[model samples]
Target: MTTATPYDAMFSGVIGQDYEMLKLLAPLAVEMSRLVGATVSQHPKTDDKPLSVVELGGGTGITTLSILAATDAIQLLSVDNEPVMQGQAQKKLQAWQAQGKLAFCLDDALSALQQLANGSVDVVASAYTLHNFTNGYRQQVISEIFRVLKPAGQFVNGDRYALDDIDQHTRTTQTEVGRYFRILTAANKLDLLEHWMVHLFSDESENHIMRESLALQQLAAAGFAGIHLSNRSEVNALVTAYKPR
Candidate 1:
């Protein structure tokens, strides 16, 4: 598991299908960047220069790679709990890190956030990972994101959130999420996500489920403002909320 091929643990052989999901997700992804940029650009500390960005839960580094490739980040750090995942990302972003343009860390998202100086980051990002935690833990993890972000920093994602009533005990719920959940009641994409989860757990009973409405409340509870649903497709939803300075 500690070997270089981290996506093996992060995807369970399923993330290879992610690029396909982008067809339904791209426009929303663009809006996400706009929201983040609008906020970061207004930072009192912001000059004409692009700000630093850190992608939490940056599994296999695809999302991090996109951000690194597309933006002018002063620094980019890829954080994940799995060393394999982080290692995979480190390899992808190594050339940038080699030039001191980016860095990667093998740590839980919250711990990685803790390693940064408070209010020092322009953006704290995660993709498809928040719903992986129970309600309480997710809140704690996100609050840590708040602590690390500069006054006008942003939290952005093309993440997958879940619906309630799945009867998964290890999960917590806030609101119902995703455009597809309301359609494929029985054969939800969780079935696909499970392909990615099989190596980590013994049963589906321990999986985390999300409800969108409740999640927004949780984000609000954490003192985030501008909660918005950016876009949607069959299974994934583009969403964002921000920490007010």
Candidate 2:
């Protein structure tokens, strides 16, 4: 009894298949989801109302599912500009949406964060999303994250935090790309491989990749306290910080 949206026509098959391929190929994604989910779940309750969590990206609902699965005490708003991507998420997380535990904002991350009132959110979380933003805009988004967080509210990001050592970063990227080609080719998923290669190129873009040192510096500069790398797997890392009470 569901109405078919335009996204269904465009992304219903290919996008979902691509994400499934990603899950198989990128183990770091699994870790990112786990870390972000556990971090959100562990936040101390502020009141009787469910914890309010804002998720950036929400691509295909992987991280969204993690956040929801980790706890029933959260009311989550997941933001993404891509209709097809969010549509994929909507399909995956329809139950939560139906239960009134989840919502979606069809907008860019920075703009969505800006719309939130000062000191409004309990946690801001993302996975493999912020590193794709242009540096200046990413900084603005970081500042806004600080602006919207209630005192003692948390920001947890499990993302591609490139190694500060350029040599190691390059070597790691090469190895990962090789693995991607091997895996996808073996699976006869060359189309997905191409998609991932393009994404990898974006991740390696000088204007985009947020190195570990810079990420910590930006979080600290944004007035977040106790900023630190909580978990790491090669360039993938879990960065956690909190707003001061």
TM-score of candidate 2 relative to the true fold: 0.92
Rate residue 206 of model 1 by lDDT.
42
Q: Tens digits of per-residue lDDT for model 1 on 54-90?
A: 7777766666666666565467777777755566677
Clashing pairs in 1: 6-84, 162-210, 174-214, 175-211, 175-212, 175-213, 175-214, 176-211, 176-212
**Most accurate candidate by lDDT:** 2
lDDT of 2 by residue, 105-146 (tens): 998999999899999999999998898888999999999999
TM-score of each: 0.68, 0.92
Among these predictions, the greatest TM-score belongs to 2
Q: Against the unseen true structure, what C-alpha lDDT does each candidate score?
A: 0.60, 0.87
For candidate 2, list the clashing residue pairs, or say none: none
